[model samples]
Target: LVVRLPLYIHLIHSHIHTFSFSYILGPMLSYFNFALVSASINIFFFIAFLFQPESPYYYLMRNDVDNASKALSWLLKADEDETDKELELMRKSVEEDRQKKAGWKDLVATPTDRKALLIRFLIGFVRQFCGIIPISCYSTQTLKAAGDSFIISPDNCTIIMGIMMVI
Candidate 1:
């Protein structure tokens, strides 16, 4: 839930911005209406954070089992006993995984795993540095050069590129 809610809100904001820009900004922009749209999205997210529930997983990781149990009970509408049992299971699973002692060296020690890791790392680095942003920027410029009006401004274009990097 900790990772999911922000992504959900971001998806909502992106959809809103895309629709607003395509329909509204494409026709208007007399006085920085795009800025207003951005501001409204920010305000909506701020309000959402005010009402967002705390994550049980985060509390559990912090070793605050009481708060974690309360959070789980609130989220699941379950009894304390059930919540405690679930939390204990989750904790055991995590500990078991940790006891496996997986690390970079484990992968490097195996030829096939080492090759896979190297390939994955190379692909990730190439995608981050070369693939996505340049393609998007080129496409945007091509569209602009062809006199195809776009609601996606250069700033938003850069922001989208940044988001791809972070993701």
Candidate 2:
């Protein structure tokens, strides 16, 4: 797990970076360039996943507690007793989670849940159909229409947007 931490962080960073770039710089980039960048990121993620270590939680689920304990000790630099206790707590949490069977239909069955669900869905739908993409894609043309000459480079804009997201 320790060895795979960097890969996990990379995966998370790539996802947030991609979304930020899409949302903030999509219009500035040519569609072809955007596709190329997206493909490159995907390939990087594939390679990272290829070398990532398997989770100890998965091993425990398969009744391989000895191997799971060893993995935990390696990641935590802790004794076997401490690792066993930690793993036991995790097993309990998984059991509790499994006992709670909440589904989408249940959300809609309750009035309060249904209202919350609808509002969340509406927000997501509105965001997807917003004109931000078109505005960004034709940013130069839009500026020209306004008789302006200023241009916003996508890379700089994306970095700024990524910082905002992190904050």
Q: How well does each candidate superpose onto the true structure, as a TM-score?
A: 0.52, 0.62
Misplaced by over 4 Å in model 1 are 1-43, 50-53, 97-109, 128-132, 147-167
- The count of backbone overlaps in candidate 2 is 2
Of candidate 2, the 10-residue stretch with the lowest lDDT total is: 147-156
lDDT of 1 by residue, 1-167 (tens): 44568789877676555544543443335347767876888899899979766777677666787887777777778787887888787677656766798876887898898899999999889879876655654544555565536577654554555455445
**Poorly placed runs, candidate 2 (over 4 Å):** 1-16, 19-34, 144-146, 149-167
> For this target, which candidate reaches the highest TM-score against the unseen true structure?
2
lDDT of 2: 0.69
**Candidate 2's TM-score:** 0.62
Candidate 1, residue 61: lDDT: 65
Candidate 2 lDDT, tens digit per residue, 1-167?
Answer: 45367779877677576557675555566889978977988899899979755667777667687787777777777887888888787677657767788786887897998899989999789867986556555544545566534365544554554456456
| Residue pairs clashing, model 2 | 27-136, 27-137
